[model samples]
Target: MKVSMQISFNLDIINKCVCHKCPVQNQSECVRTQMAGLKTSFREIPLNPHKIPKAYCLNGKSVCKGIDRSKPCICGSCEIYAKHQLSEAEPGGFYCIEGKSA
Candidate 1:
């Protein structure tokens, strides 16, 4: 049997996101833009559906090409990781590269 689950997105999770500190995010324009956008609003703004940041676990795969996989991931320490129990999902973690959790 196959089960499908929906992931929720919210400001609280984004606020506590550790992606900004992840090694994969170094000097990424995407991350920089997202950071700037977040500062201007507390709510998720889809001014450009293609520009939303964080919540890779919910937003699907990242399109950014500058990400470096050599860096260690900090998703395990994120509050969203524990709250969503993402470790149990297939293709877990590394949402930036592998996309959202299954």
Candidate 2:
């Protein structure tokens, strides 16, 4: 299931995202910096231009190498996840690793 960049980049979605709070996220400094950039001035930038781990629903796979795959995913709890009914999509949950919903 491919989601639009507009819907994925929506502030409401980003704000409600639980990726930053996930245990899988704590190991990556890149994720931290990317999260900070999104919170600061990069919020309006397209997900592809940010060079970050955000908006995986639209941006697909993460470039950051530090992520731990063993940790559980929190995408199931995300507002965007529910709003888009992502559970019906293939390779849905681990956007951080498996990439986008489809």
Q: What is the lDDT of residue 99 in candidate 2?
A: 78
For model 1, what is the error of residue 91's alpha carbon versus the real structure, in angstroms, after optimal superposition?
A: 1.4
Q: Which lDDT value does model 1 have at 86? A: 81
State the TM-score for model 1.
0.76
Off by over 4 Å in 2: 1-8, 39-49
For model 1, residues 1-102, the per-residue Cα lDDT tens digits are 222337556666667778878878766877777667765645445434245557787777777767778888889999878776788885677888887777
Global Cα RMSD, each model: 2.8, 3.1
Give TM per candidate.
0.76, 0.76
Residue-level lDDT of model 2, residues 1-102, one tens digit each, is 554334646555656777778888678988777767754554455534346555677667787878888999888888888777788776777787787776
Can you list the residue pairs that collide in candidate 1? none
Off by over 4 Å in 1: 1-5, 41-49
Model 2 sits at a Cα RMSD from the real structure of 3.1
Residue-level error in angstroms, candidate 1, position 31: 2.3
